[model samples]
Target: MIKPYTNKAWYLVLPVFALVAFSAIIPLMTVVNYSIQDIFDANTRYFVGTEWYREILNDTRLHDSLVRQFIFSGSVLLIEIPLGILVALMMPARGPGSVVCLLVLALPLLVPLNVVGTIWQIFGRADIGLFGWALNSLGINYNYAANPMDAWFTVLLMDVWHWTSLVALLCYSGLRAIPDAYYQAARIDRASNWAVFRFIQLPKLKNVLLIGVLLRFMDSFMIYTEPFVLTGGGPGNSTTFLSQTLTKMAVGQFDIGPAGAFSIIYFLIILLVSWLFYTAMTHNDGK
Candidate 1:
């Protein structure tokens, strides 16, 4: 007779579940509590009942930062998604070159975010930096500290350099999952390169592309460390994103009431957008 079914392994996972609840859920509830209150002291918090949220809803600074964040996140997805696919497609499938290519592409991801920013900061400096020296020699007037355009360009370029490898690696994994039979069939039919990519590769890679787009969008929208390190949201708010704005409100200015409200709203927006993306991507899959 067959043994009765059991799920005793679930007991092994209970400790992990408890740790996550203690770490994430507890702090989240604390934020939710703070978001609805006005505190004059540690023990003198008065229930404000969404007043902070209303104020945040009316804040013009938040509006501006939201718009800028949208632009940055959108640009990141636009650049990283297509470029990632192209890079993955060009990567070798086997042999020593493939190992070398993987290592090279992974180097950027290995660099710490703060270190990446510091590297670009020194690299972009106009006086002692190689990039600056070369640009000055060429008479390009490339000062990220003085011009908003230059600051924006530098920040965007830095982000692309730092994060593009993640997208490439994700897409590469998706590409490698396809069987040789598909390529053999394409070769048998004398398929053009574009046709093969369009019909076979693109279709197979769609799921991973969706994952890359969603991940990049979420991370880029909340980006703080690199830009904060590089420009300090400098040149008069040119590179100030939502996370920077939020951090300033929360930590820099000690506006806990508004910051808590701001964080909750921010979390909700991300949740809503992620839901939309997930729904749209999976809508036709079941059919």
Candidate 2:
């Protein structure tokens, strides 16, 4: 028997759709409007179609920041993904020990972003901070404030310390969801730990890894608050990422037209990269 489809239930979703349109669409349209025009004031403005975009595209600062953003995001993914998997594998699988492990692992994620940066900022001081003091005592020249490489290393280490727990937790949940029969089968087959993990665990972790990779990539790419608080995009602009650049243009310099154009470009880049990640992961899954 054929049944006619009714869309009456869709009417119930109208309010939610309207709210999203009001919140997101309105602001986005405003940015687009600003991007296309040079605004002198609320009453005084001139249409300058794509001028800001052209200028922004040619800006060398943008090029540098974009390159740095990619490097930072890539480094985070390479370190965090494997380190997270290792941590998850080492976590207690049962009893009160499991609860304790989860709590400890989750602690870093609970800290506020700015606070995490502040903690690290203080912790990395060579004067009184234990980390810097210890390194200096060992005759290591570790001043993140003055050195670009040190700043980069500190930022990377801080990011890993703060966010690796998220990946570990996600992986742990994925591991827990696997049926015990798979483990039993591996045992009966006399499988090596490496063989079992390589064939069984790794394949099962694909979806979760995809999720972790996408999330970590996006977050790392768009990262601003922590680095801004910690480094202020200083040490010779070495840590000045795209977000900081945008902020300097919009908030610091009040270049509304150019900032709007930059914002659009930034949003597009994120959208495109995220789409690529999703496509690649899903394509691999299908194979």
Which candidate should be chosen as best, given lDDT against the real structure?
Answer: 2
Q: What is the lDDT of candidate 2?
A: 0.94
List runs of model 2 lying over 4 Å from the truth.
1-11
Candidate 2, run of 10 with poorest lDDT = 278-287
Displacement of the residue 90 alpha carbon in candidate 1, Å = 1.0
Residue 209, model 2: Cα distance from true site in angstroms? 1.2
For model 2 the local lDDT of residue 264 reads: 98
Per-residue lDDT of model 2, residues 56-146, tens digit only: 9999999999999999999999999999999999998899999999999999999999999999999998998898889999999999999
Model 1 global lDDT (CA atoms, 0 to 1): 0.90
Q: Model 1, range 55-138, lDDT digits (tens) per residue?
A: 999999999889988898888889988898899999999999999989999999999888988998889999988987788889
In angstroms, how far off is 135's CA in candidate 1? 2.5
* Worst ten in a row by lDDT for model 1: 278-287
Clash pairs, model 2 backbone: none
Over all chains combined, what TM-score does candidate 1 have?
0.92
Clashes of 1: 0
CA lDDT, every model vs. true structure? 0.90, 0.94
TM-score of 2: 0.94
